[model samples]
Target: MIAPVVSAPTVSRGVRLGYGVGSFCTATVNAVPGLLLLYYMTNFLAVPAWLAGVVVTAPKAWDLIINPLVGRWSDRTRSRMGPRRPWLLAGACTLPIAFFLVFAGPPLTGVPAALYVGACFMATATAYALFEVPYKAMPGEMTHDYHERTSLLQWRMIFIGAATAISGVLAPAIVSSQGANGTVGSYRLMAATIAVILLVAMFGSFFGTARAPMTGAPEADRGGWREQFAAIKGNSAFIWITALACTQMLAVSMMLAAAPYFAAYTIGTPAATQTLFAALVGPMLLTMPLWVRLSKRFGKRGAMVLAALLFGGGTAAAVATPLFGPLYAHLTILVVGVGIAGVQLLLFSMLADVIAADAARTGKRRAGVLTGLWTAIESGVSSFGALIFGVILSLGGFIESEPSTPVQQPDSAVTAVLIGQTAVPAVIIFASVLMTLKYRLTPPVGPGPDESG
Candidate 1:
């Protein structure tokens, strides 16, 4: 059954913060796996690049099926604690365990090791879908106000950036610090720590949003997955925005997979990988308000256009790569950082609106189902980031050596790293600008897009 939109009667700051902290879990799972899993498999475990990519991407095909099922289940659930939080709590408890095993591997080598990673990663991806699908659904149910939705997402993104820095950078640092990069012990220790953090943050969001309302009463009329899919198909804004988000995630994934390589070959400080990332993200943290203001003033699409321009410019600048040394390199990354901050900050808020609009248009409250697709696309694209990196490396003939030792890549591979980090993303992101230009979503409909064109 469709329900009338209901904005929050009162949304406490604590509730906002609690919800935001859940992103730490999201970022840890997303960033850590994206950043290091490829490195661990290819470089440390002696897995071939192409096969490693298959191990990474195949699980997400499973996620495409699992995400919608989980989403629909949450829609049908009738629980006092709310449909989303119970699942969030479940995911919080179990996700880290699978995450630990992804890195832990079995006590074997080669194909056996590949099987272990693929199996563990599938488990981890499922656990992520459990929390994230429902969690993504929450904002639509939690509030209907345009500005308020943006505020909630702002808090979430702050934690997301922090988690990216910690998970992406510090995890690699921990592995390298162990005297053997990506060593079994190093990954075990790192995974355990990340799992603990995921638990605290997920549980925090669960209890924090405990008092929030559901989207509607169990979606009685259009309760099936077929109905949910049809509802989403009606929303053009969601479609375009989803397209944009997928590409952005893919571009970001390529860079993340290439970060350590860029640092090693381009920046020439392999051990300072975390510091390099910090420079990119630190400005993102400090400059978020500017993006907030841009969205408020210029409209979200305009702001996204601005972000796309900055992203392109930064990627183009990356061609300079230490020619002007560390300062220039850092500044280029900083520009990219500011650009990404806008996308991350504005896009999720946009999705919440899309879900709301779909509910209103189709007269079926199916935020969970929509969000499941949203999260599924996100997780799937993220895994493909690794696949893309591995393909680029293989096509470029990248070398893998002992994690503790220096292995200089061939000039062709070095060029591939540069292309992955810069050119491919630049092209893909520029295309997003076209999609953003077509978006005209506003409060009357939602924040993502409303234009029939």
Candidate 2:
């Protein structure tokens, strides 16, 4: 039987753009840390690979706990400004400070450095949860129209692509110019700059949505964690989507973490970090419109499966770098970026569909709890990208370099970097593709919303 259609207000373009600006913050957060943090600690600061991985991932551990609590708090929250905005604003204020500090570790070394980074990063993660949980909850609350949700989120993805591209290209250039002896010198400058931009975006969303209508899960939908857990757990579609999201994030993170290593060893130009990100993400930015059209034409899942295949193949093409050259390898990754655009475009929009459906069927707004859990996986697993690659690098006998002195990695370590950059991502993306075939959710199509969006 067809489920009953749901009703919710249409999201205005200005509001969509404002809400979408929030991506400027999130994309940078996702990009810089994944792209450079572990590299900074391991290569620039001479921290051991395994230790650096731990430092990067440990802070996100708090998300496993803090996010759900924040979600619940937001769920139970009462404010004229709305439940989510206060937290969003608070997070906006603090995230930049933490961003600066993550790269601006003090004049400390060894275990102390690791501990300091871990502590500061934990603070960063907290600030991120404050903004992200509530922001994510908004779409499900804002509209129940499936197609409109896709269109609304397309703008968000565009911003994400733009922000990530900006971060990817600029961060490396800034850090390279600012770094000396492997330590972040004026690196805090880049962090501070991006932090200010994040503040603006976060605040833009907060004020833009101020006059917008807000929705909550009906009281019937409110329940203990057990009940909340069961709600998402019982939903098989959510389970599969979370797995796909987690694995896809891991693949993306691995590539970001490996970028420095790839540039250093394989490309023989670590400074080519700029070229690497530009080549990879440039295609992503350019091809977003094509991906959007594909998603609209083929349904999100079908488009996602197609995207996964392209992503896997495109990344795996790096295996041919020895036969070709750096340019070819860059082109290969460019193709992967195109595929990433598809996954990025469709996945969250599809999740909103699930949330909307749940709200309709249960007469409740549980976006907070569901999104909170989803964020835990997203943040936690994505953070582990560094950890997983670190373990592999450690196992491969990778050399640790100090400030101003680039170490010559053993051949095994070079091999490790290549595999981490290419094969690892390709293999996991293939896994995601296989899993998507098992996804059995009712595709979003056919007649009917109960109301306009």
Best by lDDT: 2
What would the per-residue lDDT of candidate 2 be over residues 19-78, giving only the tens digit for each residue?
888888778988998888888788667789999999988887789998887878887777
Instruction: Write the residue-wise lDDT of candidate 1 on 237-327 in tens digits.
Output: 8888888888788878877877877776777766656876887677657766787778789877888889878877887788787578767
Model 1 worst lDDT window (10 residues): 1-10
Root-mean-square deviation (CA) per prediction:
2.9, 2.8
| Displacement of the residue 295 alpha carbon in candidate 1, Å | 1.3
User: How many clashing pairs does model 2 include?
Assistant: 4
Q: Could you tell me every candidate's TM-score relative to the true structure?
A: 0.93, 0.94
Can you tell me which runs of candidate 2 are displaced by over 4 Å?
1-4, 179-183, 213-220, 443-453
lDDT of each: 0.77, 0.80
lDDT of 2: 0.80
